[model samples]
Target: MQTQDSRARPLLIYLHGFLSSPQSFKCQLMREWLTANNPHIVFCAPQVLPYPAIAQQSLVGLLEGFLRSANCGPVGLLGSSMGGFWCTYLGERLHLPAVLINPAVRPSRFMPAYVGRVLRPYSGGTQEYRLTEADVDTMGRLEAELAQPLHSRYWLLSQRGDETLDYRDAENFYRSQRQTVEEGGDHGFQGFARYCAPIVEFLFNQQ
Candidate 1:
């Protein structure tokens, strides 16, 4: 099969986890890999807001603009953690394929624990960001919308040893879709570089 990059310029959008930035390790790794192997591909990893509702709006706007500018091409998504939750939302809305790494299958279930003050280690500043009821509500909306899977267009990558989130949630949620359950690793997904090729293939090759 012909690669999407070979047919048209591929637009790959990387969505980082909550409190994470585009400067994340996986984002940088994918950027570097695309630069070296598929220079023709256009990669974008926009920095989204901390708030769930605001973040969804920002991502939707960014993706709309990207689609407009690209005109006609394959658009792929790569999301980790909370970003994965958003990715599933977008994938369902746009009928696009995505690669989710240790995705938060039900973020609303755990948002209550973080409803108060929180430190954003990736914020680059000492300031803290507060999670509000609206954030929790937004997560609930997203979670509710995910009641139905989008067929088999997703590539779920999870690690059994993920300390932050339960990998079984993703495993159970994406049971019918393509998935990789590793024996040992954390939420960061150690040795993620090894899957870059497969991720690219899965996202861009989907019909």
Candidate 2:
């Protein structure tokens, strides 16, 4: 295990939302906030592939590689929307804490209709992203696997008026863990910058 110090506060692995790249607004905001507020923390936002099986495996492998390569111990994960789903799975597997923002708790069920020709967001244009039946099946299995008891290793941040995802889904999934539900904010939390300090404090304050 690596010792924490000025050079390494803690590893903050950020997983961006679906159809969004690692360079999404939320990820950029996080990088900037950390640079200004907590420069010691190492932040990593990897670009995930569009294919579900390949993406999940690649992300998990990358995360493990990062941990081993950096000698990071007890890292924290922060994911938004579909990325939140990944954070949930990784957090469980690694036995680490996570902060999920407007997480997609039931993506397998929710994304069934939008399975073809996904429009990439934040790429400055649209691209034809394929979603095969195999992808859906793999996601279904992942969902079932994730349905096991949560380790109480998460903090869910959700908004009541999220149009992209139903807040109840997160409310139900994280019912056993600590949650902070704000009113009137959309899927992307309104005034998200304001929550950065609090989130960092919460994650780093723990031993």
Candidate 3:
């Protein structure tokens, strides 16, 4: 027989990509889906700091707070891009399952070009922030601490036509885990709606 805690609604945390916000397309899609089909499940997509150093602090605080508040239910993570990296770290540390979408295996190697001024594509904000070397170093440190795969605890989703970050890196990194590789999709993971069902199953239905 399932205990009350075991049957409690699962909390789903959606971590958006770098330079993105909770209002991102994928985040919004998940929100809408939960609101429509699974009203009992709580969905959260907190805005993370743009810089790696600040984001590390903020993200941890958010997760810690959630863990304390939701004491009786399971929690799952759904992360895209840079957020995927964070999900992997948090999942391993918290011993929770995570679903990564076109995750960045080594963002530190590519963060140099973005060290200066950058625009927020999702939010129509005129403000731009200068990324720094310290930020890059922080990312490097986090990347260095990557946990060995818990194949049963992860689900990696990649697309062959991703233009921003190469999919091969993630494929190679998560090959031992459950993965779904599709053809002719972009960095945004076009047709994301189609995968919504599987994503939900990966997060909540799997034992």
**Candidate 1 accuracy as lDDT:** 0.85
The TM-score values for the models, in the order shown, are: 0.91, 0.90, 0.91
lDDT of each: 0.85, 0.82, 0.84
- Superposition-based RMSD of candidate 1 using all C-alpha atoms, in angstroms: 3.3
lDDT of 1 by residue, 76-106 (tens): 9999998898889888877789999999988
Worst 10 residues of 2 by lDDT: 1-10
Q: What would the per-residue lDDT of candidate 3 be over residues 56-174, giving only the tens digit for each residue? A: 88878788887887453678899999889889888876777899999988999888887876656466666567788888998999887775655338888899999999999999888
Per-residue CA lDDT of model 2 for 114-202, tens digit only, reads: 67755556565556577877788888888887765797478899999999999998999899988999989998788888788888876
Q: Which stretches of candidate 1 lie over 4 Å from their true place?
A: 1-8
Rank all candidate structures by their lDDT, best first, as comma-separated numbers: 1, 3, 2
